[model samples]
Target chain A: MNSTKGEKIFYGINYFVLLLIGLTCVLPLVHVLAMSFSDKHAIASGAVSLWPVNFDSSGYSALFDETPIFKAFRNSLIITVVGTALNVLFTVLAAYPLSKRYFIGRRFYSLAVVFTMLFTAGLIPNYLLLKSLGLLNSYGALWLPGLVSVWNLMILRSFFEGLPEELEEAARIDGSSEWRLLSQIILPLSGPVIAAISLFYGVTHWNAFMNVLIYINDTNRQNLTVLVQQLIQNQSFMQEMANTQPEMAAKLTPEGVKAAGVIVMTLPMLVLYPFLQKYFVKGAMIGAVKG
Target chain B: MSKALPPPASAITNPSQEQARTRSNWLVRKYGKRVLKQNVPLYLMFLPIMIFFLVFKYYPMTGLVIAFKKYSFLKGIWGSPSAGLHSFQMIFNNDQMIKIIWNTFKLSGLSILIGFPLPIILALLLNEVRKMIFKRFIQTFVYLPHFLNWVIVGGIVVTVFSQNETGVINHVVKWLTGSTFPFLYNETSWTSIFIASGVWKEAGWSAIIYLAALTTIDQSLYEAASIDGANKWQQTIRITIPAIMPTVIIMLILKIGHLMELGFDQVFVLQNDAVSNVAEVISTFMYKIGIQQANFSLATAMGLFESIVGLVLVLTANSIARRFGQGLW
Candidate 1:
């Protein structure tokens, strides 16, 4: 074969391998999605295939009907929004100065940040500290601890370093102060890195459950991830198996409901992915390296 | 000291520019004394973050004392009676303590051992594909699981392997051999399920860094190998693997440092009465014995113990990396 045809043959094989890998990643998701929409009887009987059988919106309808789920969703939104805002604000301010090699205390600050990353203060200290601060049973418990991420800070710092000196120099010529230059010049030009970091911060905030579970006891204050865990625990969807057919009330397995719960929480991220897919892979890689 | 901060560029050429920068440097060098005298507004923006870190991040260090105390909320951390070494003894004395430690090491260490190499392999496999559309599609699919909450991952696992007619794995086995296999209900399959689920969720997302590293490799090496009649596998093993070895080692050291936390989210979800003995990691153990039981002192003690062990592992990993000429420091 000629070079082009030979390359074509190789490309075809690569595509086939990649396609199979993609399916391996995707099939499980489809399987769950299919089951979640199926009627409880259809699911319990294993009548469903790769798609929903007897197509029922009962799972979703019942989910929306519950007051706690909606309230939890609201709590999650609040935490994600406020937490991400704080995260972006603190991480950027902290990282900007750290990126400047000429800045005083740079080494000390880097040491402190990296030390925290490598050695987590352990769960007890963190919990006790929060309890002592009277932040227990509060949403502030979630937002405050995660206000600035060392990993994200390092990435933002690297981006700040890569900025052209001439831009800042030009701003300085016009009598712009450091703060002014950062806000007006550096930030405006650093949109990609900012967006990349923001997406990461947002996702982390949205998906966070463990800290909320530890710090907040009030069900009203719990975030979506916590709420979802609660819902799955109650095995509420398993009721569908018992509800429609009394014969299977005892047989109502947790399998389908768990799948539905995973599908429910995972839906938000999966829905958000397509919109932000391009940046995520790039952001992950860029953030992986040190500043 | 009272003079303006000099611009770096003008100082490159103009003597007057050099003079202004010197004046700025002197002002800063004076312990910010001159700058404070000039402007105090700079303090406002940084105050919140400093306080946040101090109160939430650093203040927690005080709780480390509970590790040394017969902790009581009534008497408080300082006033709490000092058992000193007793709680440490309690943990060490527990019949299952060694087993817990061993289980933790097995899960985390083996996860690291197996998990570290797969991403590089996936990335290499991915990089060989020249088609941009196909590459992007595969990446998007893989990265989706990384964003999921562990609660959801656990739920997914249960859904896949639940001992029921509707469970995915059981259904398939029932179809194939006319009998269902109860994967989740069986304790023997729990750890494997945990690790496999972990791999399934993370493999694609984790490959991004390796893919990035692969991009920076010299393409000309591949070209030369191709011309010499070497196939893609040979070029990949000979060239791609060596090129990304630094990133791999650094990532490995990072993974090794985290040899204590087998991801609380993953374990907390997968854990139950049947498999809690095997799956009860340090985090889960703390959550149960300390947090749920509300034994603040004992919890703090266990937390401190875990931290010490984790610290030692990380320090060891860092030092070993240094010895390997691939240390993160």
Candidate 2:
């Protein structure tokens, strides 16, 4: 436990360097937050760095009142909630049968699922398929194609397989149906794994972008992630924002509006981050166990 | 306690046994009607999942055949006339093809080269820390960016690197050098920005796996090494790296396997007209041609090419890793 002088110096440099790297990861986000609350004149004069200069709430007021960001936020919530529900449901259904030792066609079914992970139809064909199926511009386009992620399915299935067979066997002896067995005996026992996979699904749905961009052409259906990107990068969208509220645009700078939009999109994740931090580390570590 | 335990999942899932069971379906039927009755709910639960895979996954896989067809919306996937090798020919013959392919490789190669080792190094440094609170605090900030989607990360990149007055890095650069660099517009700067942002977003999240691996190394070994006069550096070189080498190789192989996927979101969001030559990866190129321009066949061909290369790389990587007893499969 005793550290030599040389080791002490080494540890000192290591800690300092790590702290710098960690700060690099976080400071940009802090800068963005600072810009969101700073005055337009202060932001314009490049006075904002990591703290608000001439603090104002106008940018957020402008973001909520002058833009469709609220609608986009609602859309994100709907997609994430509904999408995660379906994902967890399908993942459990798929994993349960695959986990059963004597389930007919289980091996065949498992391989069939795993094969999709090894190869996929890629973006173009998947897009074409969605279009042909009348799913384009619908939330189904986002939800249906990724009904169950193979990676999450594997994680849950492995967890299910590891459960003691005695519980299921005893349930069956009581004339309990497979559905009841899963709902009562199996699911309650698998809360940690379910929570982990649910977090995985929830995070992916909340951050849904590429599918939304490719599938949903309607601006109203777009989620917060895409909306924030448009606010930040789309020049014409900025024009539309200004045109929508000339007085507000004049008052709030585009950079301030963009920063506000970014914060709005990121706030939920930040709020839930402590819980996500705890669960996801466990989830990823579970992945290290060979499935 | 008297109840006989069923076979474990690994035992039942052996490929040979599965094949044998398929060959003897009579055995499946011997327990059939009663078994089927008992398992009806299981089958019912599984039916929708099968339908999802069939309609979404396999059906789109079948749709990849459009790569060879002169696909027309009116004619439909089946009704379209066969174009033989025409679509692939266009992909190969076009001058932009080589550049696009090279750009994809150069970007992904640089990403793996710079991005792969970082997390391992970070994990080692974190492990060296005696204070648990400091290590956890550093991890919290480090892993934070990975949760943000690529769009948010891209926005951050643009914000920090923009040549305008608001851009943080450029403002500093201008103060020092008296001129601003167009980080997102110029090809060279764009590539650097792209790779740097990628590392920033992912390195900490990636380090979690290595940290997990590090935890499995027995503490006794470290204690023994220290007792033998092996300094911290010597212990890490001899014992620590050796224990985690398998995980490292497996992760490396997986990274190489995904060389073709340059992440469509990152490239699409950050790229502009000025940097298109260097940033135009296959996924973005396919999206523009297939979705925007409706050049479905050509784009499908390009996708097929990417997937096939991805498959080959994974298999090659797995086999190589097998030599070291660390294959994923």
Clash numbers, per candidate: 0, 0
Which regions of candidate 1 are displaced past 4 Å?
A: A1-14, A236-258, B1-44
List the candidate 2 regions with Cα displacement exceeding 4 Å.
A240-245, B1-25, B28-40
Candidate 1 chain B worst ten-residue window by lDDT: B34-43
- State the lDDT at A222 in candidate 2: 93
Which lDDT tens digits does candidate 2 get at residues B255-312? 9988998899999889999988999999899989888899999999999999999988
True contacts kept of each: 0.59, 0.70
Worst 10 residues of 2 chain B by lDDT: B22-31
Deviation in Å, model 1, residue B135 alpha carbon: 1.0
